[model samples]
Target chain A: MTPFDFFILSGLLFAVGLFGVIVRRNVISLFFSLELLLNSANVLLVAFSRLHGNLFGEVFVFFVLAVAAAEAAVGLAIVVALYRYRKSVNTEDFSTLRW
Target chain B: MREVFFYLFAFLSVVFAVVSVTHRNVIKGGLSLLASFVALGAVYFTAGAEFIGIVQVIVYGGAIVVLYLFTLMTMDLKNFGKEPLRTISLAAGGAISLFLLFSILYAGYRFYGGSIPATVSGAKELALPLFYRFLLPFEVVSVLLLVATVGAVAVGRREE
Candidate 1:
């Protein structure tokens, strides 16, 4: 398949992930959407690495994966902390700073 | 053929992602996300990124989803009340994403993704650049992971 195919896949996935982030109320779901966004970017990166006849893009993906894992770990910790404070995971409830 | 597998997994990835996002049950959503990741891994395989495909399945489908499920276990699920949908926000979100999708497609309409690879990339091929050329970034990422681990523990620990 062409690299265009990969880009189209990435774009659609990214759009869907962005929509989920905007509309979802749960913190966990927001994280899921975030993962989707990362995955979309990964797809495009790998395709392009192949496109240019280099492994650099693929190598970068390892960094992206590490970053994503770290983000998920820290983000989930924040969610748990927020949940302990508010007793709910809904974004509507965690608005103590919404002045 | 590679094209067939690529298209198939690509479609599956998109479908599963939507299902994961829209499902009311968080557990179901998480599982669907797992499916989507596996499909994406398959896409990488078909695209000739063999090592990336395997790593995607192991790290994303195995590690990350399990992390989510573990965090979910700590919270009581029954108490998560129904979130009422507002028509205005729904319309706005849909409109905005649709616009983005259209714009992205238009910008890349004439552009092709790139030519297909002559050789499939395996770990041996990938390891060369990762260890040599990107050694500094690799070390930095390791440090980032370590920091994130410590930070997560610090944030999540109960205060005495």
Candidate 2:
């Protein structure tokens, strides 16, 4: 496959993920969108790695994956705590920290 | 053959991603997100990053999506209710995403000019750099995972 094709696809995925993050109100859905965003970056990184004939980009993808996993773990825990406190996952209900 | 798979998976991923975002049911959205991730893994494989593709399937498809699903199981899905479907926010998001997509495509058109290099032996060749030159970062990622595990437990624990 062409690197350009990969990049274009990755860009579309990233854009869709971004739109989800912005428009979604449910916390769980937001998290899923975040994962899509991260995976899109992974796609680009691997494509670039192949394009440049270098392994650095792929190595970076590994690190990004690790960080994403950690972020998910922590983020879910926070969501659980929020659920317990407010009993809702809607972003609009998460106004306690706003003021 | 390769281009066909690429287009197929790319279409699958983008379509699923949009559905995942727009769907009101969180569990279904999460599942669709998983499908997108799997399609993305296939894209990586088609691009010749075999090891990364496998890892993508295992880690993202297997572990990460499972984590989200488990978290979803703990929540009351019935309480999700109807979303507001804000026109302004949707318009804003759509506009920004469209702008980004076009800009990226324009840049690619200008730079690549429809000529993309062929894929090399990424999986096999990545080994040396990963184990030798990038050994430190590799080990560091393990350490990071360990710390994340500990931190996640600490943060989630209920102290009475």
Candidate 3:
């Protein structure tokens, strides 16, 4: 009901997503975590938009949603292509790009 | 009643997200994530962002997660191999995220007792700002989607 409750929700989701991002080895799970991160931000945005009594933040959420979709498309394409080449989705296997 | 539903859905979403993150089966994890998103849409609805709630269900629950699941279908899941948990990394990730969570809560402490105004943001109300004020960004997002589509196709295409 309060903005603080929303802050708690967003923060917990963000924390969970960050942990997944750091600990997960699979590209697919990483993407899931990334999406969660984006969603957490969206939650806060919607909350703040309600707080300010304006639609600007809601409008911005639309852009974020669009960008998230594009990111998912491009990132998944790269992961799938990489899987074709290497036959593995593990992060350790894709370290050829690492210095 | 609204606040009750809001908290219920919010709690459910967070629980589902944790399950999604920690689940061993990727398909099951994706399903859990879908449930989480749907629950979040309910949260949005309770908060009075009706259009956003619907769009969240459609775009996130319907489109994005399904795209992930479809991409998953093309791969052999049996060969995913188990990830060995490293204690050091586990501790690090846990510590860092916990720190972040505390800091975020601290930052928002002043807003703890404050309630947001009751405002219903249906599509009709949302359109005025989106189509009028943010028209340029709207068009740019369209172009961005187009570019992403092209780039994905080019990258995923196999050489003859």
Candidate 4:
């Protein structure tokens, strides 16, 4: 497949991820969407690395993976804590901080 | 052959993502999301990013999705009552995302006319950059993962 094809695929994945983040009310689903968005970006980075015949973009993808794992760990912890205290995982239920 | 795999995996990823977001059962949603991630990894493979495709399948499909599923198992699924399916909000999201997708496709079509180069770098090529150039970030990420693990344990620990 061409790099252009990869770019288009990643772009669609990112758009779907964005839609999920905007429309999903559940925090966990939101997190899943966020990961999808990150992966889409990773896809593009790898494609560019290949297109330019450079390894820099691939290196960046490694760092991104690390950060994503960390984010997932911490984010899930926060969600679990919120669920414990509120007994609900809906975004609206945890909107006490909204002004 | 390559283009065929690309289209196949891309279609699967998009379809599963739609199902993931729309499914009412959170566990099923997480599983569908896992399928989407695996399909995306296939897309990466078709693009000649071998290492990335492997990492995507292992980290995203294996670890992250499993983590989400474990978290989902801890919750009461039946408690997720009637979701507020806002018509206006759904329309707005669909419109914005469709516009974004079209814009990206247009830009890609305009900018990427030449054939992609035939050089395909494997895992060995990625190792040098990971260990040498981006070494500090790599180490820092390890630290970040450690902290996240400890923090998760501390937060999830029950009061005695």
- For residue B152, model 4's alpha carbon misses the true position, in angstroms, by 1.7
Put down candidate 2 lDDT per residue, A1-99, tens digits, no spaces.
Answer: 556787788789888888988888888888888888888888878877877777788888878888999899888888888888888989999986797
Better of 3 and 4 by lDDT: 3
Residue range A1-96, candidate 4, lDDT tens digits? 666787787787888888988898989889978988898888878878877888899888878888898899889999999888988999999888
TM-score of chain B of each: 0.96, 0.90, 0.98, 0.91
Ten-residue stretch with the least lDDT total in model 3 chain A: A53-62
**lDDT (CA) for every model shown?**
0.91, 0.83, 0.95, 0.85
User: If ranked by TM-score, best first, what sequence of candidates would result?
Assistant: 3, 1, 4, 2
10 residues in a row with least lDDT, candidate 4 chain A: A1-10
Off by over 4 Å in 1: none
TM-score each candidate: 0.97, 0.94, 0.99, 0.94
DockQ of all models, two decimals each = 0.78, 0.69, 0.88, 0.70
Q: Which residue pairs show backbone clashes in model 4?
A: none
Spell out the clash pairs found in candidate 1. Answer: A3-B113, A3-B114, A4-B113
On TM-score, the candidate that comes out on top is 3
- Per-residue lDDT over A7-35 for candidate 1, one digit per residue giving the tens place of the 0 to 100 score: 78998998889889888998899999999
Q: Candidate 4: misplaced stretches above 4 Å?
A: none
Per-residue lDDT tens digits for candidate 3, residues B49-83, read: 99999999999999999999999999999889999
Q: Residue-wise lDDT of candidate 2 within B1-160, one digit each (tens)?
A: 7788888998998999989888877778888888988998888777778788888889988998999898888888777777898899999999998888888777766445443355655567778888999899889888888888888888778767
lDDT of 4 by residue, B52-146 (tens): 88998999888988998988889998887767889988998899988988887877775466655656667898888888888898888888889
TM-score, predicted candidate 3 vs. hidden true structure: 0.99
Docking class of 1: medium
